[model samples]
Target: MPFLQDPPRLTNAYLADPLLRELVARALPGALGEVEPELEHLGELAAGRLFAQQAVERLLEPRIEHWDAWGRRVDHIELTPLWREAATLAARHGLVATAYERRHGPASRVHQLALVHVLEPSLDVYACPLAMTDGAARALLDAGNAALVERALPRLTSREPARMWTSGQWMTERIGGSDVSLTETVARRDGDDWRLFGTKWFSSATTAEMALALARPEGAPAGSRGLALFYLETRNEDGTTNGVLVNRLKDKLGTRKLPTAELTLDGARAVPVAGLSGGVRAIAPMLTVTRTWNAVAAVAGMQRALALARDYARRRAAFGAPLAEKPLHADTLAGLEAEREGAFLLAFRAAALLGASEAGVASDAEQLALRAVTPLAKLTTGKQAVAIASEALECFGGAGYVEDTGLPRLLRDAQVLPIWEGTTNVLALDVLRALAGEGVGEALAAEVNAHLAAARDPALRPAIEAARAALARAEAWLAAAAGPAREAGARRLALTLGRTLELALLAAHAQWCLDHGRGPRALAAARRLARHGIDLVAEEPGAEELELLTGPSADGGAR
Candidate 1:
């Protein structure tokens, strides 16, 4: 037999993750004793059967069949085998149901999102539809529509595979991407319902059973103020298209197996969710839920990338020794590990806060902290996911760039994290919006200080001081900068605050580990992240200088 490079294999996701275990134990206490079995089983599935299946399965994309032999408009979408299997797995595991079930009280969300974190990376972006489904459930529940809630909530949270249903979020249009205020979709009153008529430029999870869409009603004003949230079933009782036309399945760079499509609503029957206006306001609950999912997904992607790279380091040989034995290779992997640790803590903190809020156990400080941290976690982890994935790919040399090796997909899929729920810039501005609320910035600072206070280890003092200093600098910048300057430096400020919080949380968790005899690995992570630069805030360039750098050239030539 010739010498062939060994491919990386995942160990049990739950068993291999000391950080998750420790955090769960600390945060959830006795709940881990009950959830451990389920986590262990999901971890096995992720590492074993699903992982093996993914390795051998041929890459396939969803196809839309517009017509049959009779030339009737069928508009049927055929999904990949893995995706079909993923739906059943998702339901049977109670991935979404667990959160709403509140089996662990305020910690149920922690358990549910933990399952998602473990299984999502192996499921080929099945989390996309799940995120929307979770969001739709939250939105419907918050809308206080008794009829709609009764009809959909049970099915959305059902554990039975056959009964469970997924929903789409149809908000994007050609004219409006993030700014739903510019939505062009229109709704007209029918006999007892409304009919949506417009195009949805980018509709992910097109195969979902239902969707929450935004449309301006007839004789209504323009902008998001006049828009109403509507719920529509994708098909009628006879399993026929519900006046929704699927134009084409998108050919994407990654998540190719997931069906994203261009859709046209030609008189799709719908019922108003709340009222005939404030659709944008109504969808806020949904965005909060989905954005948390986005952050967790980002962290999961980073974990998967790091897992593969680390495994390969032990298996692959260079200079007559395993790559893991090389100091430089070890250092590179260590840096990535630190990033993953920081990202994990930050994302999971958001999940924990959400759980508490939903369970009505959150204090005033936690409520305000949740508002600020949600956007921070999403934007921060989104960027880290891409950076870590890129670096992890490089660890594999040329193999990382080869599609057949299944390494390039890590980077491609990670690219969507920062772009999906919101782009980095959009989320940065959102952080500013959260800060605009009274007491939000103070609440966030207090939360950071609370975490930092838990660390008594002298070895972790430097990281703790760094986090505090970065946070102080960010507050100073915010206090001094005026409108345009603040907006211009929003991204830097958001990143600084996010990274500062991550370092603080990491230090606190590392302290817990040290006290519990779990070793100094987490402390090392905190130190490394502190060294990675927690303070990103800088002086905003003046208007004239900024224009000169970013605006069109004097002669109108491309700069």
Candidate 2:
């Protein structure tokens, strides 16, 4: 045989990740014994059979069957073999039910998200529907509508494959993307029920059993306040479309396996989630839940990419020696690994806070910290995922770019993390809005300091000081800036806070590892991340200078 390089193979997602194992063990010492078996099993499936199946299977996108032979319109979507199988696996694994089961109490969220981290990357974004399903379940429970809660909550949280249900969040329309205040979808009273009439421009998971949407009531006031959140089944009792017209499936850049559609709702029957108004406020719970999923999924993607790249480095030889033996190559992988560790801790911390809040075990300061950390984690990890994935691709040389090797999908899928749920700019503004609440800034500072206080290692002192200094600079900038200046620097300020917190959390974990005789790997990670720099705030440019740089020039020529 010719001298050919052996391809990389995954042994076990759960076993391969020491960071995940240690974090869970430290955070949920009491629950690790309970959740370990399931986590280990899912990790095997994700790396073994699922990985092999995806490698050999023909890549297929979802297709719609518009009409039958008799001219009867049937908007049926056929999913790929993996997607269909994913639904069953996800249900049996209790990927969405684990949090609601509360078997581990407040730590249940950590357990649930831990399973999601291992399983999502292998399922080809099947996490899309599961995220919405988890969000809808939380939103419905919070709404407290007796009938809908009774009818939907069980199926949504069910572990049985046959009984489990997924939901679509149909909020985007022709008029608005993130700004739901301009919604034009209208609702008309139909006795006790309501009928919705409008177009949803971007509806993901359209094949879902049901959906939560927003629409303006007839003669109601304008803007988001006029809108009401409503729940509707996608199909009627006869298994026909419930006045919903699936116009067409989107030709997306990534996540092609997912069924995203542009929909026209012609009087689709719906019931109010809470009441006829305040839909924007009512959907807050759903946003918080889904945004956390986004952050977790982002970190998971980064992990997958780095794992493959690291394995490849160990296997491939260049210039008569393995790439892993080369100092520069090893250094590159270390940088990527450090970024991944920071991202993983930041995202999991959000999950921990959420679980504590829901279990009613969190203190007042913790509750306020959760409000700010949710958006920070989402935006920060989302950006990190794209950057890490792109760099990981370069580590593979030419093989990474080849589609047949299945490496390119890592970058393509990661590109969606920053765009979905909410874009970077939009989420940065959300962070500012969170700070507007009473004691939110102080609470966030308290949370960061708590993490920094955990470190006792002398070697980790520099990283701790760097984190504290970066946080102080961010606070000072916020106090000095006002109006347009504050808004203009929102992204830098948000990133500064987010990265500062990540460094602090990593320092604490590194200290834990040192105390437990787990060696200096985590301490090395904290040091590297500090060297990468946490502070992102910069001096704001003058209005005229900014306008000149961004706007059209007076000569109407290219700047």
Candidate 3:
């Protein structure tokens, strides 16, 4: 059947759709670039590689180890580079896209979801001194000398990675944690040389030879606006220190791979980035990518937890049947599946949008969408991933709680997704403000309509109609947001509605594939989820909660 679910469903669809599979195969780049493997988090491909050359007789290495490593809370990032390098090569060689849609088909989205969770890095790469293991300083000219090596030289149509990681990270200070305005990092100008003073608190402050840092020059504007994006490099021909110091590691809850650190900058020399007082503007693009990645990581966590649970249910038996065979267990599985699909759609659709947008081509509209969606991804996915892992473990009873079962690792790893980048309330407020911007509702509506048209599923008609009504009711709720209480209530409704809109768009996209005769599996999955979504939306609390506004009984007004 045409079940257009997330990865597993997508995998079937991908195989059925020859064109998609071919497209992925043609898209992969062979040798010149780095690569990454998505299976490390899912079925456990990494630990397999480590044990490939086993001394045991007739026993091929276990594939399960790679999967277990994903459960490692803070160290997954450390294992990421190898896969990244390989995956990059495959994409470059026309084997796949960074999303790996070409190679894995629809399943690539699943792979990507896994990758982010496993390689999750807590700090913003650009701001984190621990952004990379190796350190360097780069000034303005260096800012323009980016290492988007594969991206700069493009070929024919395979989905572009649309990755926004600049070969840098420059926004942090000894005083800068959540507040950027109070940064004490100094960049002193000396006839093209801007010397830096101070350090970074939790900068993964690693990557490329040069970094773009936020610095305040002598007698600059008072606050964040006054700062400039300066470039710094590690070397000065002496091979010693360029005044940029790698202080120490950050002991944290999760995302400890790539090394979050306290860095030192003692007269670290740098150069003035172009556009005076453009530090904020210069850094915004980088921040957008980072925030988006953070969101992706959260979604990935959700998918991993869901996948783990799904696998457990299929295998773990209780009460004379597999746990998944039980009715309550089935219901739990269904909920997790629903959450996973919704999150996958959110993550990939955002990536697809960013890929389609021109480089550095950010609009207020786009920014608003990013702000509104990213936090939802973070909050919902992070919290849900934990729950999914825990519940999946419950299916296994005592084994699930044990370290050998690896369920605990999944929960522990997901702990940091929401905390990093920005906290929940911070993102929620941003969503509120962004959605409040003029015509956002209309814009969102247009987006939804376009997706619906693409889905084109006759079987989805009932649910679609229901969803339409739900959207209308939800809109009315938004419109009625007047007082503080009303507005607060409306915001909650809006958030749920927004999530619906996100799912609706993806459901529509999946439908478009089936309608165009792409994959039966995707079509089936889409039908199920789209129908479910419609039902959910139609069940608006407001419609039921409020008394019907009607005239008196027809028989007699007094009666």
Candidate 4:
């Protein structure tokens, strides 16, 4: 086998698949062709792992000599050829290529939840680089920041234990993790010399050298706007203390090993990222990429959970027959499949948005859509994946609850996803603004109309009609909505309207492309996904009303 860390610097082969080709052609034309190679690499990694059960059985290296509480030796998983290749190449390229894909491609649902329900908004810790804790935040982002990120990315692809690329997101305080606005950490400016001070509770200052810290600038506002981002690189030449202190680590329900560090900054000097007022907004963008990955990870965990349930159902007999033969069990499997597929399509569409931004050609409408959808992607996907895993575990009956079965870890991992990035409530708020303001409503309606028009499958005709009706419902809602009342009404309408429309659009995209024959595997998968996606959206079915109704006096929408 090749000594590489991941698939070769190749485009994803699936993009060439019939279904994916079709989807790409419809969703993105030239752009679709461009992602082919990258997607192929993703496919290779997935296929290789799927082919070698051992590759996936243990996601991390088990070679290290350690023991769980039960004395179970930590298992060291051998790196797959593709994984190795990816890692090695990432090191050479000074960046982790498709690190997001690595986690998301396999477990999209779980990844979605982490960012949506927990990670993004929770001051419980972990800061997005886009937040207010980096110096020269904008300057660094141009080239230097990208370099550091790229340089550290490959280490993550390797089988090493500690996560790489995630430098520091300081959120502890002498008071408490909550109410960060009361944080006392200070960044004193002395003759161009910036030094950090004050003790932070659960600072985690000891874990990694680099940190995006929030510090008070002597006399400043009392709220969050008074913060700044400092790039505190690990300066300890010998991998030792670097003018920072880690008081202790906290034991938590799920992410126990991830290290909840308590820290102390002792007159530590750091590079200033940007103006103090811009910290929150600056670092907020960083969550954009990572949150997406969290959502992807959630999906991975769910898939693992499903695989476990599927395996058990096929092998274990409950009443003189395999559980798979039972109707209820069969229905459960179908539901899981439906949920998993839906999560995949949603997450993939979000990824496409990221791809567009990277290409430096994203439109205003698309960007706004991305902003709205990313959170939705995180929240909905996370909740679904976690719920699916629970169902799968339930399918296993008694055996699933056992820690030794490994099924439990998937659930635990999934549990952390929604709580990692931004909470569902926060997402709900963000989406409300997106749909109510900006060109989101009109753009979304037009997109929906187009989506319905693209479908060739007669099976979806009724659903398409219903979806149009729903769009009409949404359109009517938007037509009459205004002021604070609009926002309140927009929230509920936004979710179903956005999701239903995007799903239909994505379906039509896949349908048109597959029939036309463009990209291959990616398009083929898109088509498969489109059919399923349309079906899923059809579940909520919408149809345009002939006369159209108005007002916020209706069920969760404009009356």
Per-model TM-score versus the true fold: 0.98, 0.98, 0.66, 0.67
Worst 10 residues of 1 by lDDT: 550-559
Tens-digit lDDT track for model 2 on 62-86? 9999998899999889998899999
Can you write out model 1's per-residue Cα lDDT over 229-268, one digit (the tens) per residue? 9999999999889999999888887878789999999999
What are the candidates' C-alpha RMSDs? Answer: 1.5, 1.4, 11.7, 10.8
Query: What TM-score would candidate 3 get against the native?
Result: 0.66
Steric collisions counted per model: 0, 0, 61, 121
Candidate with the larger lDDT of 3 and 4:
4
Candidate 3 structure quality by residue, lDDT tens digits, 60-157:
11111212344531211232443234334333333212332324333343333333433332111112221121112112212463432232213211
Error of 4 at 384 (Å): 1.3
Over the full model, what C-alpha lDDT does candidate 4 score relative to the true structure?
0.52
List the candidate 1 regions with Cα displacement exceeding 4 Å: 1-3, 554-559
Residue 525, candidate 4: how far off, in angstroms?
Answer: 12
lDDT for each residue of candidate 4 in 58-171, tens digit (9 for 90 to 100): 343212222457864332223334333333333332122232343334222222222222211111122222121222222245334565445443433323333433355665
Local lDDT at 137 for model 1: 97
